[model samples]
Target: MKYLFGPVPSRRLGHSLGIDLIPFKTCTYDCIYCELGRTTHLKDKPAAYMSAKEIKAELDTFFANHHPPVDFITLGGSGEPTLNANLAQIVEIVKNLNKAPLAVLTNGSLLWREEIVNALLKADVVLPSLDTVFIKTWKKINRPHPLLKLETIINGLKGFRRKYKGQIWLEILFVRGVNDTEVEIEALHRVLEEISPEKIQLNTVVRPPAERGVEPLTKKDLEEIKEKLGPKAEIVVDFKRPIEERAELLNLREEIIALLSRRPCVLEDIVHALGAHINTVIKMMDGLQKENLVDAYLHNGKRYYLIRKGER
Candidate 1:
């Protein structure tokens, strides 16, 4: 599964099967809070990063296999998926599979392009992030490409809302001392009204971020922000559904390694992802830590595990 990873747990999409279309670290913005680290290939132009035929073939094989039920067939992994020039073709291919509702998780930086917006029209849901409304804050937080403009990006989102019929869940990730100021929030509130997304999801740093000194806001802070954003807004909480039981466990150790290699996960995330008992996950973590294959760090109140830097 070179391109696809996880029927992994998601707070918004339930158990999402992720499809990676772009190469690792290729994105339009290099945000400080990115869990997968900094964007190494920062470009705005879309390219044929992977063959659509190969992706479709992988999806075909995936549907043929007996696996856990997934809520969404998500097009997002490692980088900005919209960077793949074959986005519309890939979307068509996934919709043809008809396994589950398709969703696109993007940064929404390129949605200003008519072709990019048109390419996403077939998706069941589009989850795009707009971290800030002010150009200064946007630059400081998102660190977007030189060519990107806040006004243009906002217009793109507004235009997309007008044309697309599917639901849009616009995400705004808040980082303390950055884009969480009263003026910034007020500006965002005004812009969000114009964008008019079906849902406004507020998120913060839950995992280890790319840069140091990046801090998450309190639940209290998020609740207040939600209040300010009105009825359509809600805090993006952790996935709390009961883990589905599997008749036969897959290679638990390898699965854990594969997951951690992509992004750090807490104990609960590992349990939910593998559908294994917490004790079992803990034992595996102990072994991996002993082998120096993985390492753990505390963020906020929860502990997160990831593949050791040297191992990765």
Candidate 2:
């Protein structure tokens, strides 16, 4: 369970079983709006940070359990997944398992590399983020590595689209006054047309982000952008469907603490992660707070819960 962290609910992928390939915060971009805090190991090079053997062992152990059904086995967590050198081998391992459809979530920075594109060819679906088309806004929002270029990333996406046969759900996260300008949207619309993803998911900051003052766009704002982006575009909404029961979720305190240690989550996130009722999660939070095991603070109207530092 060191790498596999959820059959957590996802708005796009339903109940996704997440696979963490890269180390925590090891990424190509240190985006201001990232919910998992800042990127600590910012690099563009792909490395064997994790071995295929280790991933295979974890997936085998996970599948051996009688767990709840998951919609997709997603290769993503903590940081950019594409940076893992054993991506193709890991993808093959998952495909061999045949438990569920495999999906790769990436920042689309490394897609310009032919090897990276080839490595992802076996995935059932790929979700890549393209926050902005403009270099200034791209840097402002994504804070990408010095080696990354907007043009290269776009070309990579376009190249991948040409070769890959699977579904591509392209994500564009809008930060108010940063990447939400009229000019950038129009440019993005043009670029998206060329890439031709099956869906264009428009997202804004909903969770507590790495930096302060990073604001989310309103529903009205997103709707207008969706209209401009045309029929393929849809806003990424919160996952509302009830989660299927997992037999092993007996210890709510441990589960909540485990999730929070990875990243601060709202009550809704805890509910989805644990597949527990909202009221149940609320009660658990209250108990944890009283026990001094967890602490919460409000950010942009959302209360985020986290494990108290140095509290085991």
Candidate 3:
């Protein structure tokens, strides 16, 4: 399962099967709050980061033995999945193998290129990252590659929206003390107004961030940010309702719990392993805590999730 992992659930994309085409954090930006840590191969353009044939072979092997089906074949993990040169080909192959929709989880860096835009045309969903709308704050928070330009990326987004006939869910992750200023929110609001995505998902560091300085935005702050972002904006999600369970999720909750049993972790680790969402995690943790299977603690100013007595 080199490329295939977890028909894991997600707050945004229900039952998801994640496809990691790029290696660890080989992205266009070194975002401050990335769960997988810093972007190691930071680049502004796309390249042959992984072999398309290899990815397809991996998927062939995965779908052969996997169960249930899937809501979406999500291009995610390690870094910006678009950085993989053969992404378009991979998506084409995936479309042939499954009835589920396909998605690309990106940093919104490469959308400026016409070729990249063409490549993603068949994808059912595109979840692009827009952490900051202002260039200064964008640079400060996302720390994009030297070759990257904010205006160019924005144009790319607009171009993609005009051409692609799929759902575009824009994500804006706020970091306390850095990109969470009132001014920054206003800038992001203006940007959202232009992009006009089907949904604007507001998020924060609910996990151990790549850097110590990065922090989560409070619920109050998130509400304000959502208001400013207008009608399309959605606060931290709550993925509780079941969606006819696509993909094989047998032992998913158990496997996630087993992982947590080893050590205390925030929502990101769970998301990393299970492909679930933070909202789903909040619900799962609450349930586990009620059953005395999990414990909650705070370290420094951040929260830590751990296994409870007898459970560990």
Candidate 4:
């Protein structure tokens, strides 16, 4: 309840239960279009960011109830999860509790470390973001740590590919005017060929992005990237999410408030948990907040929701 966020429906991961290990914004890069906004502590180091025991205890509570099933247990939430020294331990615990595949969505900065790669080997899926291929583009898009080098990151990814056994899904999040150029795409192509990921997921900024009006890549531009990346590239439309029933959808927005009374749930986590359409959930959340049924707060750049009493 404290560390686990959701059994939310993900377009990529299906029903995902999120485990946030590190403190908010404690990542190596500060992506411009990050839904969580600007990074505060832009550092990536292996440390005891959070305890494996604590995370395990949270999972124990959730599994004890065993109300619903999740498609996967995801290691991502407030910050880059790999920074937490206990990530491997957390992954093992998640696997023991829920046999569902454990997925980790990361920025891919730390893949250079063998220890990190070894830690992540048991995961079913590892979604790593490589926003740009060239160093300039990398800086423009990710704004990485002053000490982090593009070459090192690339080599690290290559090394990870050779050693890691799980399926690697490479994610490239493009901002309109930042790293969407032909040259950048070509570099990405080369990198993709080297990484040989099982999938290439193309994405864009659609949420309350860190910078407003960063602009979404036009259909034509996205098409060009898709063509350049060849058959491997697949664009994840900024919109659309997993949902089944409208009645269940409505209950999600209301139930979400009660659910978060135990832990903070993010926008994506809520959508995944309820398996409700994102737009529908957003509209209802707006109305609920207008009536003061729930509370929305930003912690270290990431927004989270919780139920507020004496309102709804």
Candidate 5:
């Protein structure tokens, strides 16, 4: 499980199994709103952070257990995934596994590199973030490497749209009093016209962010912005996960604790695993939260439950 983290719940991709290609906080940009904390290394070059063999071996071990059905095998974790040098080979290996549709969550700063874009071709979906179209805002928000140019990145996305046949779901994370202005939204609209993503996902700071100044936008504001961005834009909402009776309430609580002892998971992931009623699960989670048995944090607009540090 060194490389694989979750068959965790994802609002966009369903029960997503996460693969951490790069080391923790190792990325091209150190954004203010990152939920995983600050980027320790701001890197632009691709290297074999973890060997393709190691990643494949972890995936093999995971699938051998045949845990449950997952909607996507997502390449994302504490850092941007594309920085891993053997991405293309790793994608092929994952494709061969055929456990689920492959997806990658990235900042899209590296898409300018033909190698990076080519490697992503095998993925079923590519979720890339573009917070701002203007360089000053981009620099302030993302704090990318000096080599990373806004113009180059935009052109790269446009180029990727042409070469990539897979679904491109473009994400825009708007922080209040930062990139949420009318002028910025208008600029984003222009970029969207060029990129033509399958879906334009509008997001904001929903978690305890890395910086104190990062503030979330109101749902009302997001709705208005979505309208401005046009028909393709939509807010990423929580999934209505299936709920069915299974074990007794006490047993269900034990199961949840056991699962979270290993890794964090979303409500839907817990529901799908336990087959318990969502209301029952919520009640249990609330009890755990009250008792400090578990904790919750928002990532990508979805609340995730995890065992508190040292509680396990």
Candidate 6:
């Protein structure tokens, strides 16, 4: 499962099975708030980062082993998925193997290209990021590659909206004092109207970010922004429902608890032992805490998750 990462929980798309198309940290923009840290490749051009055959093999193995109820087979991971040269081919292959909806998560840097837009036509949903509309704010927030122009990216999104018939859930990650300014939000609102996505998911930095300067907005601030963006917008920061059992997540939860029962472990410890994504681990930890099955305590200034004594 080199390319396939998870049937992990998601607040938007439940039980999303993630497929990593590009190599680790390879992307067009080195976003300030990326949880995966800085962009290592900083690539703009599309090339075959991973072979279609390899991805197809993984998909086959995954479905054969566990035909878990997956909401979406998301094409995204450590980097911009569009950069994978054989994106359309991979999508076609996956679609042949599964009935679940297909999705693509991208930074929207390459959407302006006609080829990229056409390639994504088969996706059931496309979630592209839009942090800011202004060039200065875009530069400051995304730190895009030199070849990626702000205007080009905006126009590309607009163009893609016009051409794409699938659901577009445009995401805007605002940092306090960065893109949350009055003028910035106003401009973004106007552009968002032009894009006219099915939904506008507002998000901010939550977990530890790549850069310390990146700050998250409070729920109060997020509510205000959602109001400004109109009825189509909603905050996607938190989840109220429990993770579905259909996601085949019981095993993951059991595994985490077993490791914690032996000894308390940090997020990294669970991830390393299980070879799971950090985001997935965080969500699992949140669910475990909500159920009072696990708790965290600071040890040597680092928080570690542990099984509750009563349960133990």
Distance from true position, residue 204, model 2, in Å? 0.3
Better of 2 and 4 by TM-score: 2
Assess the local accuracy of residue 230 in candidate 6 as a C-alpha lDDT between 0 and 100: 97
Of the two candidates 5 and 6, the one with more favorable lDDT, higher being better, is 5
TM-score pick, better of 4 and 6: 6
Clashes of each: 0, 0, 2, 3, 0, 0
Find the 10 residues in a row with the least total lDDT in model 5.
238-247
Residue pairs of candidate 6 with colliding backbone atoms: none
| lDDT of candidate 1 at residue 131, scale 0 to 100 | 91
Per-model TM-score, in order, reads 0.79, 0.79, 0.75, 0.77, 0.77, 0.79
Model 3: CA > 4 A from native: 237-312
Error of 4 at 72 (Å): 0.5
What is candidate 2's lDDT per residue for 210-259, written digit by digit as tens?
89999989889999999999999999944222122222333666788889
Clash-forming residue pairs, model 3: 69-247, 70-247
Taking the tens digit of each residue's C-alpha lDDT, what string does model 6 give over 218-273?
Answer: 88999999999999999998622323442446788888989999988898889889
Per residue, candidate 5 scores C-alpha lDDT tens digits across 1-312 of 567866877778989988888876889999999866678889988988998999999988888886877899999987889999989999999999987999999999999998999999889999999999999999999999888899999999999999999999999998999999999999899989989999999888776577888988888999999999889999983322222222356688899999999889998889778776454576679779989999999999999999999987
Please, what are the lDDT tens digits per residue for candidate 1 over residues 78-174?
A: 7899999999899989888888999999999899887889999999999999998888888988999998888899999999999999999999999
Candidate 1 Cα misplacement greater than 4 A, ranges? 239-312
Q: Note each model's CA RMSD in angstroms.
A: 8.8, 8.4, 9.2, 6.6, 8.8, 7.8
Q: Please give the lDDT score at residue 84 for candidate 2.
A: 91
- lDDT of candidate 5 vs native? 0.87
Off by over 4 Å in 6: 239-273, 277-312
> In candidate 4, what are the lDDT values of residues 1-312, reduced to their tens digit?
556776877778888888878876788988888766678778858788789899888877887785577888899986688888887788888777756888999999999877788889888899999988788878877889898888988899998999888899999888988888777788789888999999999888766566667777866778788888989889876454323344565566558776777677887788778765454465567667787777899998998887786543
| lDDT (tens digit, per residue) of candidate 3 on 8-36 | 76888888888888766688888878766
lDDT of 1 at 76: 93
